[model samples]
Target: MSSRQDEVPTLTQPSEATRRPVIYDVTRIVTRALNAAPNGIDRVDFALARHFLARDNSARGALICTAIGPRLADPDLALETIEGVETLWREDGDAEADDVYRRVVEALGSKGFSGASPTRARKTPNLLYLERNWRAMRRWAPHLGRPLRQAPADAIYFNVTQFLVDRSWYMRWLATRPDVKPVFFVHDLLPIEAPEFFRAREALLHPRRVSNICRYGAGAVVGSQALARRLRQYATEKGRPELPICVARLPVSPSFLSPAEPPEAFGGVNYFVVCGTIEPRKNHLTLLNAWRALARDPAPPKLVIVGKRGWLNDAVVEMLERSVVLRPHVIEAGGLSTPGLRRLLAGARALLMPSFAEGFGLPVAEALAAGTPVVASDIEAFREVGGDAIDYIDPLDGLGWLQAVRDYATPNSPRRRAALERNTGTVAGAEEFFAKIDEFIVRL
Candidate 1:
């Protein structure tokens, strides 16, 4: 078993002359159990922390680990802690628990399903579970060293994950630090732009988060030009016309670049993979419906759904749990390791992403990096990342998606052949991404 360090890009030490004063707020990486499956933002935060430490070998670069309150720590120590946690995270023990639960549920028959009914007063054990985790996490707090006494420099970088923007204390602390400039990485404006897909509370909170960024941030980094433009428009509307915004597209994770033996999960069967959380915005229902239509076909290809269940997706859950037609064809692989995901993508007929919206589509880039075909939504972010290499279709076009999937599923697919031809040569690497960020920092 190769470690994650072997698979993901690591920051190499830079010349002393090029190092700058930078502090990374690693609140998300430290607090979150990232060893379990991490979403896109978590990956970005983790990568950014590593990348920042790589730039400087001395105290000029530091990492601040915070959960509700900020704490300053040695960058090296933070990195070590992050690596340790990630190693432990990769050895996720959820599968064993899930297997046990499955056995219990199976034994109970329909009663197992009925136990989760709305009529029953749910016994909330989550609070107790959280308390246990919190106690364990507190053991690491001693190693966090001390609270941030003062800003290290004139500028600081924060890539807000875990919705830390809404925390009043942190924002107030940031506001008071007039000497320090905050450069934030705005992954997306999805909550504000497409509020219907998110919870009402999140929709309400996101505007405030964006407003705070505009007010307190020295500059903002966006993954796409489209997002950068959107941020500028938002800032201007909020009376910050001259807010500095730059485009620094995210790089493909090095794990996806490594070669892997195709997993036996596919059993040599041609299958299409849909990566990311199963949520309303990802349009999983559309894919499920299309698969339902294809179920009648004598030689239909398999569809592998590769993400954990997320909120506002009861319909998708019901279909996955109860649909007879989808049962044989659709495989829900919720917890795949990085290596497993790379192997799955590498062996797939094509990566299918029918997202209704996106800030930056990482999976599209990852599939291209793995030399696999991609059939993604015709969104600007996908276009920016995939260029002419991908096959794009409207997310709502059920027949169109079904047809594209069928075409690519063919043994000798022209679309697949074209994707292979176009995806040749390296996709963007972290070196370029870091260079752009470094250049932006210097300009600041």
Candidate 2:
């Protein structure tokens, strides 16, 4: 048992002097994303919090946005807290978490089922939902504000992504607290990668946040080495000393790896799967084209796209609505249950993810664990996770993706078998990563 624990990679547990650490999760981004529905980042944040809570009884306190109306619901409030440490819901803060959620829901809901089958309810307009829910949220927001004042003194705040976008005077003040050590999770520099999608006013705010992260943060946590390198470069450009950064790969719950019997009905059709929000950086348009090209061949496998629609791409959404070829071959099942996702991964011939940017391709790891082969873009993050296991393709090459998709469909190759074997047990357990976190907290 002792030897097995050592085999897992985690930081040393803190000494007797250190008790359980209180951590604040500052997540304006998560709140906004959740408002958008099919909230992937929010889901990740929830999973991370769940893991931390389950692993250590001593770990306490969490601060999050409550999307409830300015007045509060007891169930939502109670659901957000830790046993000993404080948990704060700051929906009343500048960003107005619930306000955004309502807006996003309405926006998607308003689109009404465009070209969707009567039996298939997939996507909707979310922005309009917010407008309808706004007045109620205004009432709810005030109740959420009162809790932040009472958070535990020894808490170490964990900020996910850039909350600095909201320009909350309160958040900046909270950052300088003497007892709390602020830790920020750097997911990706998407604004840097694809600036056109973001509003100019918003895009300019990150450099200042990066500077603050370097100057004041106890440490910055990145999901991959690729992001760490990008952060270091950002540090160098700003002339700030590079601070300590840790790479914690994305984690899926143990349930995802559980045994599952294949479905009784796959209907004799092979399919490729792509999961993630349908956004510009995800390069879904290129994927659609590749799938279209593949459809020209006889007996082409279906393309299963699982995700909610995301910003600044009306054309792709329209294509999804109008494309004749996409209808029979495309399976658009937006956001699935974890078990459903696991089953899909287990049965899939390959996970086709041509994402141009990622901090750590979590799905790629999940696919490998499910014994599914992957054909991913030859980007740094994928390389970090997939190593030589993935059939790498350039995002620019449609022919390459089509060929790779074909190659992946006809499996039984030695390379595919070896990749799945190599990926097993390669990722560190959640406990180990959290222990490293505990050690980091003690030193601070």
lDDT of each: 0.70, 0.58
**Off by more than 4 A, model 2:** 1-20, 26-40, 51-59, 64-140, 144-154, 164-168, 197-202, 411-425
Positional deviation of residue 228's Cα in model 2 after best superposition, in angstroms? 1.2
Q: Among these predicted structures, which one has the highest TM-score?
A: 1
Candidate 1 lDDT over residue span 182-272, tens digit each: 7788889999999999989989988888888888878777788778778888888999877777677788777777775564433557678
Alpha carbon deviation, residue 67, candidate 1 (Å) = 7.9
| Candidate of highest lDDT | 1
What is the number of backbone collisions in each predicted candidate, taken in the order shown?
1, 29
